[model samples]
Target: MRNPISGAISTLAARPLVRSALTVVTALSAVLFADALLSAPPAAAQQGFGNFFSYQAPKPRRTAKKKRQVDPAATQRAEPGKAGEAKKAEKSGPTQPVSIIVSLGDQHASIYDANGFVTRTRVSSGQAGHRTPSGVFSIIGKSRWHRSNIYSGAPMPYMQRITWSGVALHAGVVPGYPASHGCIRLPAGFAPQLFGMTRMGARVVVSPSDVQPVEFSHPLLPTPKMQEVQVPQETATQTAQQASVELASADVSPDKTAATETKLLNPIAFASVLKKRAVAEKAAASAAEKAALQAAQTAGAEARQATTDLDKAEANLKAAEAKAADPAPVPSAKVQPASQAPTDTGATPSPEEVAAQAEVAQAKAALEQARATKAEKSAAAFAAVEAYKLAAARAEEAGNLIDEAERRSEQVSVLISRKEGRIFIRQAWKPVWEAPITIRDPERPIGTHIYSAVEPSADGSKMRWTAITMPAAKASTSSSRDRKKSKTAEASQAAVAPPETASGALDRIELPDDARQRISELLWTGGSLIVTDEPRSPEMSENATDFIVLTR
Candidate 1:
């Protein structure tokens, strides 16, 4: 029913080429119309559709270049947190003995001197599996710009080793938590400062919680054996005046001399000197001891030889006496020589008898000579033996002196092991002595404790002690409420409570008289005594380290 014209349009639209031609012709006509308007005057374009259809291409961007410059000051300075570049040994630091306490609970470390607290800084301890052990340890070794032996040569600048089994304080990334491989990580700025302040054998107490050193005293604690100082003919004031005069003559300030004396009195400085002296004295004593022993052996051999000579002389004398007593019946007259005639009087002796008598006399003289020779040899041997004994005694005295020097030079370490039911003492990393000790109530746990002889009293008769008790490991069963309650109770407790607890431990312990005496004689400032429920740490090998007590 479509109209013929309409039919023709529909038929053309159905063909794709005819429809596309029509669309292009219509678009071209519209573009020509728009271009004509845009090219017209602005008033004409505004009146047309060109205003609504305006378009413009975007302009390209321009960038300015900068020239590079080098800064001399920046190049000379150490980069921030660069530990390797900061490796330096400070020439001056704390003069007295220093102690360090690391608290795993708060993740902080504090340094102390003979006087009191010095400083504290944040630290990063070990993570979950590789936990930093809680214990009383000492700085056994140190190195600058060290690398881990277990790990793949990871840098550990300003390393201060506490345990031989790889526990130490070193500079590394501290993420404010337990994140290290059983080592204590310190900040770059603090590590070098601490390293310079501390020395080998410095007591380092690593505990589960924060603890501080306090003035502690107990009757059972060993007191120093004070020796009387023998003054010279001149008084101390006179000696000082003389020294001042000498210094003045040398054009030196009195303060300079005083400073030199102070340096000499510094514990670390004098201790090192004493240690070297002790070693030399020990060597000399050993040589003297060996020589004296050899001399004794030689003297003993000579004594035996003299005895043998005496015996030989006695035998020879007896044989001669017997021959002389039974003078072979004067050989019958027929056997006698013609010149040898028997006298009628018994008083007159035969030539043969006279010859026998002369032979006996000669034997007597020879025996007497041998006796005198043996007497001289025996006296010489006795004298030599006495001389050896004197030498040996001198060597022993020298050894005792060396021991005294060593005790003064190095800190003494005492370990009271509840598991072993004994106490062990070490000096200069050597086993000085060990003895059985009785601990009351062995069944119940007494906990781990560290007591340090921080410094001597003004009178030098007693030492100021600081006690730190290790906290129990974090238990899954323990709740925050209980922890808080416990902490509150501890804080509220009387200050005397700490010293009582430490002294009470000493009361529970009973030492042999000799052990007590020896310990007293050796006790000095910077020494430490550790009481632990656990046995000796595996990190402690024979003659390799001080007493290592692992609380965990």
Candidate 2:
């Protein structure tokens, strides 16, 4: 209040100091607020600032304390009660070669043999980001007491590999959920059982949800080339045994022996020779049978004619003898026939008596000739019948040989890839042939489909086929839990692409003439054909397997 200029300067300086103090206080309050927010529960923080400042930590519930007391290891392994069930599963093993179907939704695997269902068991598949793929696969490799190559030597006992890319079914702790890193985990006891039941090349189908194999029928399904003649089951069995013995005795490298055998006993060449021989033998049998029948009929007729002639000749001879012995009672005793009667009684001087004697001799000779002719004809007929039977037997034997040759040849698998524009053939997991194919529309997806030749058709004119259509790419989100998953899962479900139906898939492919012919010639019961828009999978390694489809 003393000087006006000095007071104004002091006021400006005081204002700056006040502003600095206010800024420091505001920064301190902000730091305290951030600390409170960081300390609050995540749920409370998400609720908003209204609760953020006032949030209070609640006391733990009794149930929470109880849960903590439980053994943590229990959640990391299979249920203790399941050990007995696993043992039971191991005892009732499959009788035939088995196929496996794994359902991601249920986390269970169902096994089947050729006849039908075998057994089912719990499994643990891949978790979250490392989701296991879904598609038709095959057990390409197996190992007991195996160790993971990618996971720092983690124990993977009784591992059966489906893909060379780290995917397999192995023994591990099954915690009733998807806890694995890509491989399917089985109960400790069940794993060895499955390993014992399975073989390399066994079919394995993994899907989003549980899907059953239905009795599917279609006309477009490829049929096996029917043999004109069917060989008996007995003959086929005998042939198989003989072949097994021969193969077992051979002491040579399998690869070299197979090649040599193929050349020496070429199925095609062997079949050709057998077929020709069968046809010729059948024709010869038919001719012989017909000739034998005709000969028998002619001989029978000749024998009857000869018998009749012999009887007639004997009757004539008897009549002639009677006439020669007692010439006609010549005129009877009353009419001057005394001279004629006396002359013919002792001497054969009368012309009528001499003629009757010559007639008797001729009749006897004709009867003897007829009897000899009948005997000769009967013997000829018997010989002809025996000859016909032998010829028929020869024909049947030729047909059996053809059937045996065919049975010895393994059933072949066929794959038609629209993307590759080619058809591939494999037998015993080895490539046999390949040829170009044509798709109706190269841009359109044909979808993956597996067609199996189940058995022969009713009339036996062709093979009966059953098909299995693989799930679409987005099918992995099929489970209810997966449906309610994060936005990524929902997007995947929303982008579900429709897969082609089994019949429709077959209709799109246009096989070349040679391919069709080859398929017909090689196809057999249990043989499979795969048609898809994708090219051959990398998993179908060189001379290692049939087609391997992956639908992720």
Q: What is the C-alpha lDDT of each candidate?
A: 0.69, 0.66
CA lDDT of 473 in candidate 1? Answer: 59
- Model 2: residues >4 Å from true position, as ranges? 1-97, 226-411, 456-462, 475-497
Model 1 lDDT-worst window of ten: 244-253
What tens digits encode model 2's per-residue C-alpha lDDT throughout 410-498?
Answer: 55688888888888988767777898877787788878777766555433346656566766645443766765563333133333344
Q: Tell me model 1's lDDT, rounded to 2 decimals.
A: 0.69
User: How does each model score on TM-score?
Assistant: 0.55, 0.49
Best by lDDT: 1
Error of 1 at 66 (Å): 25
User: Model 1 clash tally?
Assistant: 0
Model 1 spans > 4 angstroms off: 1-95, 229-231, 235-404, 477-500
Q: Mind sharing the TM-score for model 2?
A: 0.49
